[model samples]
Target chain A: MNGAEKIRVENLTKFFINGKTAVSALENVNLTVNDGEFLCVVGPSGCGKTTMLRILAGLEKPTSGRVHINAKAAGVPSTAVVFQGDSIFPWMRVVENVEYGLKLRGVPLKERRAVAMEHLKKMGLERFAYLYPYQLSGGMKQRVNVARAFACDPEILLMDEPFGALDEQNRLLLQQELLRIWEENCKTTVFITHSIDEALLLGDKILVMTAQPGKVKALLDVKIPRPRDIILIKSSPVFIELYKEIWDLLKEEVLKARNIK
Target chain B: MNTTEERLSQNRASLGKEFWLKTFSFLSPLFLLFLWEALAALKLVDVRLFSSPSRIFKTLIPLVLSGELIYHTLISTMRIALGFLAGAIPGVALGLSMGLFPSVRALLMPLVAVTFPIPKLAIMPLILIVFGLGESSKIFTIAIGVFYLVLINTMAGVLNIDPIYIDVAKSFKASRIQFYTTVAFPGALPMIFAGLKLGMGTALLLIVAAELSAAKAGVGWMIWRAYDMFDIERMFCSLIVLAFLGFVFSYLLDFLEKIVIPWKKR
Candidate 1:
């Protein structure tokens, strides 16, 4: 592990126990995420990438092995996750949703509201700060979710296919929006997605995982320059090459997952 | 231009039809009332059995002016309010705990299932024996009825909350109090309100049953008294008041639901 490592996973494994059956979700997954790194993990469905993210977020416990975060000397490092579905509280307004983390931490109401509003503005959602989550479109709700993760100002962000439910237009729009916010904040992030193009577009390094009982297949460095445009980045030669490379690795896993000829 | 004009006329005709349909819907009850009045005036039916609407109103007006109607209405309302609070508060608390804690659920669920199906009125004799044929018995009967309805509904509400919301709360590192107050409670609120509405209706039903069995006061007792005396008009008056009470209680709950859960509006 490098001195700059923010997160280190050592042979992490998880098995879901149901009645008399134990299903392996992940197997011997070892990885390190450097400080302020944007690491995207791409894989076929049932690859346990979400399970890995959940473990990192402390929402789930690995059946074996361990994950260590390089916490500051003061306390444990704070981490926030953006889940795949609409995880925003329907009862809370957009601003309240964004400020949820700070509120839970016992930050005073006024200060938290200010921080929430600031993040909302960054997402260009200042106008919708008072609106309820139900009033917003799916894309807007996801924006609120992203803004909330950013507002918490955690040491790391774990996003599990946050925009996976959106349309192609919304998916691209949010990808760009996420990049803009990430560029500004640059927190250590582990984003899990099934989209190879998305993995290349956002990740500093893309970790591809194998089919069921997921293990790291490859970690390819994205070498794409910063201040990337979502539309223009796709046309670049290196971007196509990276996409093809990841796709080539991912196709076998997809077929293997589906048991297709 | 001609087609546009034709479409406008068609829209206007449909609008006119809709207006009359709504107006007719409103007038339907009046039509029934007038028919009853006509039948009584023409001596086409037995006046003692099917009292005219005017006669019922006349009896009601006197009862109101003499404060008899108001007194009985207040008594019934007070019993319901007290009994509903007694039942609903504990029911919701227990239900929430039952939904959240496995041990509590294990302890209470079987009891709830066994007791919920038995009509509350069936246990009136037991309640009467325990509390005597007094105010306590009447109130207790209503409370028990409301309790089961609210408890089951509340438990279902809590259980029905999407697990994802709980996961989100956990990920955010919400404390126990915050988890319940901010996530679990609010997530279960719509269902809780649903439970409360059902419980309120049950409270209304059970109150009348309890009152009819033993009470000297209340609209239900008045109806029974009028029946014994063969004062059909007075009985109709009491029935009208009971209907009004049910309407007001349901309307109050609907109004409270709107205020408490503004997000449910649209």
Candidate 2:
């Protein structure tokens, strides 16, 4: 189950046209995620982590390099991206936001509502299903966003610092909710984050990346057991060991990001 | 408890604030009418030329009872409604496409920019000549004015939508029809309502201008006819009715806006 590769990226390079200069965002980046595995990526600021995810989500085109998602079967969506900040449509109710992908896929209205309501329940947002995004708090809005991604039930979930903007308590609650959902329904997920602790907590394997013109630095197997106790796991020796290893791999890139080294 | 006392006091404060607001609103018009009545009673202004609030009220009653006021008001109202719908529907369609697709914008923007600024009143003579001095001509002129206001505003509304919404729709693989129905239409609704209000205002303005120039029966024509017969009080009566109509139309639009955009700030 673990070794079956669900996604493969080979020498992924991406460039942006910045007026006169062809600015490179990602340089010869290569990575893979096995089926039902959680891969967390840590990188410095402006490191094109989002660009890589956008490419994976097919929202962007790479300058060169191939990205292949091994779709297990026809009719299952290849990817559904959980964007960084508040991405829920303000005009839509919470249920509508969660049902957006299903609606786009032309699912029947009744089925869409049922599926969305189930996902909202998972996020502890069933009570607010009929409310608009504007009526919700920042943390609640992010949960709606996550619920929408989960409702899509795509082949792979591509999250780009989904909890980066949340306060600590809300972040932990959401991480715990995410773990429960993933445990119930195993999904191939590639999550990007700035926090080493988040990477240590959620990832089956951690992908440490470089600064600008992002390149893969290291890919370390987490070996942390299932059902991670998000709070208590911090005190565990193995979790602390993995945390130091990731920080060491990420520290030089952080310095390079600030141009201090 | 102190909490209950605080809540009670808060409610009382809000109620007191509302009471003062209503009182001030009531007093402003009454104060203006009193000042005008004083000026006229003291004979500072010619009574024949400057009709006082009392004189206008006297004029208003007979015209209203005779059904002349209601007839002209309804005629003008019907024209505004027709012209507004005719212009706004197509304006929304074109504006929506122009906002969503750059090609449509490129093809039509030059035409819009050039024609939008040319005064609608200036084009009245042309419209009258082309459509013939009929109800259609007046309606046509009014529609032209409303079209530009709604189209430009609706287009801006669509363009101003946060790009994150667009990205969200795209990531979900929304079809073209879905994008328009869900993303573009609902997202731009606030601006569309703004455009509709502006369009309605222009509709009112253009209809009066059209009627004054060429009509035999509407409030604008009534004002013109009163001026011809030297019926000073009657002219004032028509002006008051026109002001009321404008207020009613604006108020109706405000009420509609609240219903449509429920997610807006309270």
Q: What lDDT tens digits, residue by residue, belong to model 1 across residues B182-205?
A: 987888888888888888889888
Candidate 2, residues A105-210: lDDT per residue as tens digits?
9889999999999999988899999998889999999999999999988989999999999999999898898988988878989999999888888989989889
User: What level of docking quality does candidate 2 show?
Assistant: medium
Per-residue lDDT tens digits of candidate 1, residues A35-136? 889999999999999999999999899999999998664432379999989999999999999999988888899999999999999888999999888789
| B1-266: candidate 2 lDDT, tens digit per residue | 57988999999999999999999999999999999999999998888898798998998898999998999999998888889888999998899999989999999999999988998899888888899988898888878888888899899999999988888888888888989999899988999888999888888777778898778899988988998998898899888888898899999989988888887766
TM-score of 2: 0.96
Top-DockQ candidate index: 2
- Candidate 1 residue runs with Cα over 4 Å from true position: A1-3, A73-77, B1-14
Candidate 2, pairs of clashing residues: none
Relative to the true structure, candidate 2 has a C-alpha RMSD (angstroms) of 1.9
What's the TM-score of each model vs. the native?
A: 0.96, 0.96
Q: Runs in model 2 with CA error above 4 Å?
A: B1-14
